[model samples]
Target: MHLLGRKSKKMAPLFLALVVSLMTFALAVPAIQLNAQKLGEGSTTIQSPAGKGAVNFVLDNNNPDNLIGVTVSFNETLPAGSIIYVKLYNGGTLVTSASKQLTADLSAGSGIEIDFTSAVPISDFDRVAVVVKGPTIQP
Candidate 1:
């Protein structure tokens, strides 16, 4: 019994260190919040004059890589200074985005391809959103 007591005393410092290490690890790890709501799906109503047609998010054919670009066809020509915004989402979390402002008018029924800089791993994101903002009207 005395020998066992002596062994335990020798192990005390090591046991305390292990406990401290575990506590440190637990503190270093980030906690996932269950209550917080993540931004998910978004829906927008398209008016009559301007309509969003077929959209394809695929790998660029000209510069084939792991990255992807968007090919969109609009019903009508988009005006100059119009802005196009593309967003990639993995579940509710936004993965990446790209925005480009039109320098000239886009012709109707022409498939326009918009590229995203630094876009990679085309398979990672599941949701793709595209928004086009027309040039402001002057009174």
Candidate 2:
């Protein structure tokens, strides 16, 4: 047992030196930061012709993140009691959808932002289409 203690004491200094070297490396090294650059034209917009009931806009966000929201607009004041649907699609398959009811106070030619925060996993080169369904857009 005494011989074992002597051996352990001899190894302790080596272990302590290794630990100190690791600690110094950890403290001396600087942290690396990463960030994603959003594209200048990160969104898509489409104008619905008169008498058309829907406006289809395809946004090929060949980007790093899935679409988060959309801003819809009507050439004229949205009809009262209008039911607008915001549909998201990927490669002809429907992913998710959202809806908004037009109020009297909503002005014409203004944008209606819809949030689709819960979207499917989107990768690069993914084709995401946003279809806005509603009455004809007066223009």
Candidate 3:
């Protein structure tokens, strides 16, 4: 099946676009941390920053409103050409996904924030995952 169930055709393009963007980030980079929550709030970091895997997280927005663009921050410096894929899921259905390519090497102890351009704003308790992978080995 496609990214989501066979429903609205209009949304299919948006979903595909997110996946297609993620596909370009298929570069080799080191394992890093991901923080999709706002500052001063509870931790939202993705665990197991060593191997290529998906980390599940919950949006910690207490406000009674759908989360608009989300900024995901990385804890470590990925290589100059690393790919990152962020997916947000509402229950079992995939809400939206985004990908980013690092133009410069991320320094250690540094963080990179990303904005999600989803058709629907993310909500609290929504499940989120981040998969970091690459085309080759890190330098």
Model 2 lDDT-worst window of ten:
49-58
lDDT computed for candidate 2? 0.60
Q: What's the CA RMSD for each of the models? A: 12.9, 16.3, 24.4
lDDT of 2 at 35: 97
lDDT of 2 by residue, 1-139 (tens): 3655878999989999999999999999999999979755556775443232324333336743555556776665565546667765657777777777666534566666666656444552245344434554464
TM-score, one value per model: 0.57, 0.42, 0.45
Count of steric clashes across candidates, in order:
0, 0, 2
Tell me the lDDT of candidate 3.
Answer: 0.59
The positional error of residue 76 in candidate 2, measured at the CA in angstroms, is: 1.6
The lDDT for every candidate, in the order shown, is: 0.77, 0.60, 0.59
Clashing pairs in 2: none
Q: What is the lDDT of residue 98 in candidate 3?
A: 77
Q: Which residue pairs in candidate 3 have backbone atoms (N, alpha carbon, C) closer than 3 angstroms, thus clashing?
A: 27-134, 77-106
The reply for model 1, stretches above 4 Å from the true place, is: 1-49, 58-65
Better of 1 and 2 by lDDT: 1
lDDT at position 121, candidate 3: 42
lDDT for model 1, please: 0.77
Pitting candidate 2 against candidate 3, the one with the higher TM-score is 3
